[model samples]
Every structure is written in C-alpha cells, then in structure tokens.
Target chain A: MNRLYHYPLSPFSRKVRLSLAEKRIEVELVEERFWEQDADFLRRNPAGKVPVLKMGNRLMAESSAICEYLEETHPTPSLLPSDADGRYEVRRLVAWFDDKFNSEVTNKLMGERVFRKIMGTGYPDSANVKAGSKAIKYHLDYMHWLLDQRRWLAGNELSLADFAAAAHLSCLDYVSDVDWNRSVIVKDWYAKIKSRPAFRSILADQISGFPQPSHYSDLDF
Target chain B: MNRLYHYPLSPFSRKVRLSLAEKRIEVELVEERFWEQDADFLRRNPAGKVPVLKMGNRLMAESSAICEYLEETHPTPSLLPSDADGRYEVRRLVAWFDDKFNSEVTNKLMGERVFRKIMGTGYPDSANVKAGSKAIKYHLDYMHWLLDQRRWLAGNELSLADFAAAAHLSCLDYVSDVDWNRSVIVKDWYAKIKSRPAFRSILADQISGFPQPSHYSDLDF
Candidate 1:
C-alpha cells in the first residue's frame, strides 16, 4: 500500500489525493505537519513538503509528479488523455491551478487567512485578504470563460485539469472564501466533480483546529 | 517553423526554450511583453501569460504543457524516460523546479529585485530580497543533495527536470543573483548543462535596462 504524507487543507495534497482516488489507488493518509518539519517527514522529502508518496521502494514528492506516476502505473480510469496534444492541455491546466491560481487566489487568500494564523506568522492582513478576494473573481471568471468554450477546462473530456481546479476551490470553500455564485458554469462543474465517489474521502477530510464551512460537505454544494 | 511567444527573462519561457533545445526542436523565438497584455497575445492565451507556442494552426500556452507536447510529438532524444516510474520521477522533479522552486525562490527574488523595478511597483523591498536570497541557499542545497545521488536531476539521464531548474537559475544568474559557489556539485552540474549547445540562446539573452552577469555567456564559467 502507498502512504501519503499530506495536510487536510492543502490543495496540492488534495490534488494528489483526488488523482489517487480517481485511479482507484489505495493510499494510507498520514497527516504531516509540514510547518514543523519533522525528521521522519524530512527523510521522506528533503524539501519538507506535503503530498509525499511512499510507493513500494520509491518515495516521491510533488503532487504533479505523484499524480502522473499514479496515472501511468494504474492506467485505469485514466486522468490524462492518450494523445500528446490532449495530454499537454491537461498538464497546462494543472499548472495553471497549481501555479497561477495558487499564487493569485489560494496563497494570498488562504495563506493569509488560514496559514498565517496557523503558523503564527501574524494576523491576516485585511488589505491582502481583500486583494485576494478581488483576485479570485478574475480567476473564477477565467474558469467560466474556459468552461464556456469546452465541456471541461482542457477540452470536451474530463481530465486532471478539472480535479486540479476543484482541489484548490474546495480548499478555498472550506474556509468559506469561494463564492460559488460567481459563475453558474463553474458551480455546476464543481457539483459534477464533487459528487464523484472518489471525492468522498476528500469531502470527509476534517482538520481538528479548522472547522469547515457549512456547505463544505454538502453534496449539492 | 514553430513560433514561441516568450520573454527572454521569464523563467517559464526559459524552461520551454531549454526543453526545445534539448529535444533538438527548432523554433522561431518571439519575445513577448506579457505585462503589456497585448490584444493579440491575450487572444493567444486568455490568461495573458507566456511562453505560448504557436505550432502551425495549433496554439498552446503554459510551459509544462508545451514541453510535454514537444516530448511526445518529437520523440527523438527523449526528455522523459520509457517506463512509467521513470517518467513519474522526471515529472516530479519538473514540478519541484517549476512550482516550489518558482514560488519559494524565483518569485521572491526576481519579483522583488527585477519585476518591481520593471512594473514600477515602488522600490525593491530589502526585506523580501533578503528573504529570497536566504531561501535560495536552501533550494541550492537541496539541489546539490539531489545531484549527489543522481547524474541528472531526475535520474541517470538528462530530462526536463534539469531544464526546469537551469531555466530558473539562468534567469537569476542573468542578474548575478545566484551564488554559484554555494555548492560545488551544483556548480559542476550547471557547468555541464551550461556547456550544451541548447543553452547558447539562453546565454545570449539580454533584457534592456537590465544587464547580464559578466559570466552569463561564458561557456567555461
């Protein structure tokens, strides 16, 4: 069995978990205190980050890499398309969520509001929070624009791109930071993805100190 | 000829350029002012980012995606390995460089020292620069550790991961921000990669008003 070192609210970890679940790969979930930088965890990932996967003899770090590994080894219920161009689209969208979206929305909003408090960095800066709030609208609008053009963020078929976007949004939703009403397309897309059987574990994730928003676990939400 | 819309100093663009060079794919380079958000460029990528690839009738955005696409379509001198596990390792390292490295080091250092001056976001924050400078040492140490174990970043073979790391470092090196003496292994590894013919264009890159380091183009440096 594979073991995953992760944090409940981390979108990167959530993205890996979602990919594992989608591929029907079983993994033992081990909550890691990444901020603390535990020795054992450090051994698993010298970088001292979450979403590290211990699979067989290989200990892998980085969500994108772990997800792609799972997709390649499992090959069932494929998360990436077979074609090169199609695969490129999926990887691009995944990068978009992990890099751009995380920077513009998740890190700014969630990092300021949640992680700052947890890490004892300082109180959340209202100005940064407000900026994050405004920035999210643009991202959500971008998602809507993409969804309007295709059935999924990448194309007409479901791919890892959707999961990547959802993972980030779900984390934001946990803190009640996401305004689902911003875009009907994005809302419907989330509803479709969240209702999946694979999403059950992610939906059930509970962090002791951080209480989830009321709508976090609701299927219809 | 394939056309790449990019900025010479953009790490993401540099990653794609390195990958194309490694794969021996010839592309016409078009430097894009992403900050300008030109209408034509925006039409190419709704997000208004580079490096975007225009290949025949198909236009693609995002560095990871473009690299993957190139790897698939041009399988000669493969950037990724044949096995699933090997490919996973490569992808994982790529993500480490592209996402974590970019966030922890590149964004902090480059955004503070270079981007702020270009965007006129006010004077560079010494605190941020100090933090970035400090953070990079940690990242360099981590890279050195990885290089200690493997011939290349992902494994025995050169892969996209090396290009990703080199791209980020090259951008910093252009501004003389990288402390090459921090790790002998890292320096040797970079020197080996820098000596490649693929790195020639990157070495020659010049950003107006921002001069390159004295050794930026020195193959033997």
Candidate 2:
C-alpha cells in the first residue's frame, strides 16, 4: 500500500495530502516528527522532511516534486494546467506560498506558535509573531485581489497552487492564526476549497495539545 | 525578443540563464536589484525577487518554473528525462539543490559574503558564514556519494538537476566560498559541468566590487 509519512500541521505534507485525495489515490497516513531527525526517517528521506511518500518500492521526498510525480503518473483530475503558461502560473504560485509566504508568514507564526511548542524548541518569539501577523494581512489582501480577478488562485481551474496556498492557510487556521474576516473574497475562496471532499482529511486532522478550532472543520465556516 | 531581469550572483538567476542558453533561447539580460523592490519589478513579480523571464508577451518568475516552461516549449536539447520516475528524480534533486542546498549553503554563504557587501546589508555574519562553510562539506560529500553511483547529479543523463546544482555552486564559487578540493569525485563532476557551452556566461560573470576569482573562468581548474 502507498504510505505518506507526514505531520498534522506541516503545510508541505498537507499539500501532498490534498493532491492525493483529489486524485482519489489511497495512501496510509503515518505521523512522523521529522524535526527529531530519526535515523530511520533519515534513511527514508535524507532531506529529513515530512510528506515522504512510499509507493511500493519507491520512496519520494519534496512535496512539489511528489505532486508533480503524482500528476505525471496519475494524470487523472490533473492538478496542473494543460498549457505551459498555465502550468508556469500554477508552479509560480506554488513556490510563492511554499517559499515566500511560508517563510514570511507560516514559518514565523506557526513555526513559532505551534512548531516550537510541539518540537520542544522554546516559547514563541514575540517579534516573529508580530511580523507574521502583519505579513498575513498583506497575503490575505493579495489573495483577495486574486480571487476577485479569477475564480481560483491561479485561474478558473483549481490547480496545485490552490492546494499549496490552502495548505499553508489551513495550518494557520488550525492554530487560529488566520483572520477570516480580513478579506471577504479570500474567505469565500477558502470556504469553497475547504468544502471539497479532498479537504475532509485535513478538516479531520487533530494535532495534539492544539485542538482544531471549532470553525476549522465546519463546511459553513 | 525574450529578456531576463537578473543579478550576476543570484543562483536563481543563474539557473534560468543556464537553461535559456542551453535551449539556445536568445534573451536580453537585464540586471535587477530586486531587493530594492522597484514598483515596476513588483508589478512584474509581486514575490519581489530576481530572475524574472519575459518570453514575448508572457512574463515569468521562479527559476524552476521558467526552466520547465523552456523545456516544454523547446524540447530540442531536453533538460528533463522522458520517463516519469526519471523526471521525478531530476525534480527531486532540483528541489534538493534549489530549496535545501540553496538555503543551507548558497543563500547563507552568498547572502553573507557577496550580497551583504553588494546589497550594502552591513558586514557578513561570521556565524552564518561559518555554518554555511561547515554545511557545504557534508553537501559535497553527499554529491560525491551520488556521483559515485550516477554519471550526473540526478542520474546517468544530464538534466535541469545538473543546472540547479551548478547554479548554486557557481554562485558560491564566485565568492570563493566553495572548497572545490574537498571531494575529488565532486570536483571532477563540477569540472565536467563547468566545461559545457551553456556554462560560458556563468564562468564569465564578474561582480563589480568583487572581481572573479582566477579559477572561476579557467577550464583547467
């Protein structure tokens, strides 16, 4: 059976999970505290990161790569667009969320607020938390603007870009970091994505100590 | 005509440049001080980073995305493997270099040693430089181990993975931060990749304040 080694709050892992569910590919989910850097986990993925997928004999690391691999092999219900330009836009936004938005917001807010406590690192850095809080508003505004222009994050088609973004935003929502009322359009966009069958597992995700917010799993939320 | 807004020492810029040259795509190179976050550059890429590619009317950001676009549009000298699994490996290694190796090595060393002075970001952090220097050895060893198995960074065939690895390493090489003598196998691998026609522009790169090291352009090095 296909297996996914992931953490409940890891946006990267969540991105892959959304893709897998959207494609209807069943995979056994195994929780891994990747930061501990266990030798066995290192053997599975030298990168020592989560969302390591084991498909029969093949073991894959890197969320974006894994997503692309799934797209290439599965091809059904494609997460990427058919055209090159469309594909570029999708990948670009994926990088934006996973790289830029992630570092500026997710890593700051969630990394400090949730990850630090869970990983036994230390208390949340107030400075980082403040910056993340400020940065998130701009991100929400940006998303609002995009949702206003297009139906989905990248375009009319719901691409991996949406999954990439929703992955990060959902993680923050788990810790009650996102302000749903900040942008009506952005909120509407999230509400639409969150209602998808693919998002069920994510809504069901229960991180220890940090219980899911009442609204996190609500379809009407 | 196609144009690329880039900076000499930016690995992300170098990666796209290499792919463009390899694909023989003629493009006007425009040096963009992206950190300054010019309003026009922001309009081009809201992410506010370097290596933005303009292909006719379509403007593109993100190095890997640009490379993939180039591969799809111009498949003559293909940068990706034909097989799904092979392509996955190439992308995995590309992420390993562009994301993992980049933050751990390239960004740390270059961000401190070269960019700090060029961007006028104050003095290099001795701690980050020290950590980057220490981390690169393990990376080189890892590369050596990989090279011991496959002919190229990802596999037997040359792909974007090679360009991605070389792009970051070349940026560090510019600052004279890479210890090329650390691993003979890795050194041999670099020598081979460094000799490619696609590498001409990278080898010729010279930052204004910091002249290219004597060995940077030397094929025999």
What is each predicted model's overall lDDT from 0 to 1?
A: 0.88, 0.92
Compose the digit string of candidate 2's lDDT tens values, residues B110-169: 888878887888999999999899999999999999999999988998899999999999
DockQ of candidate 1 relative to the true structure? 0.77
In angstroms, how far off is B133's CA in candidate 2?
0.7
Write down the lDDT that model 2 would get: 0.92
Backbone clashes, each candidate: 0, 0
Query: What is the lDDT for B34 in model 1?
Result: 89
Clashing pairs in 2: none
Poorest lDDT segment (10 consecutive residues) of candidate 1 chain B: B212-221
Q: State how far residue B36 of model 1 sits from its true place (Å).
A: 2.5
Candidate 2 ranges with C-alpha deviation above 4 Å: none
Model 1, B1-221: lDDT tens digits are 99999999898999999888878878999988889888999999976899999889999998888888898899888999999888987888887887778878888889988888887788888887888899899889989988999999889999998999999999999888898899999999999999999999998888888987688888667
The TM-scores of all predictions, comma-separated, are 0.94, 0.99
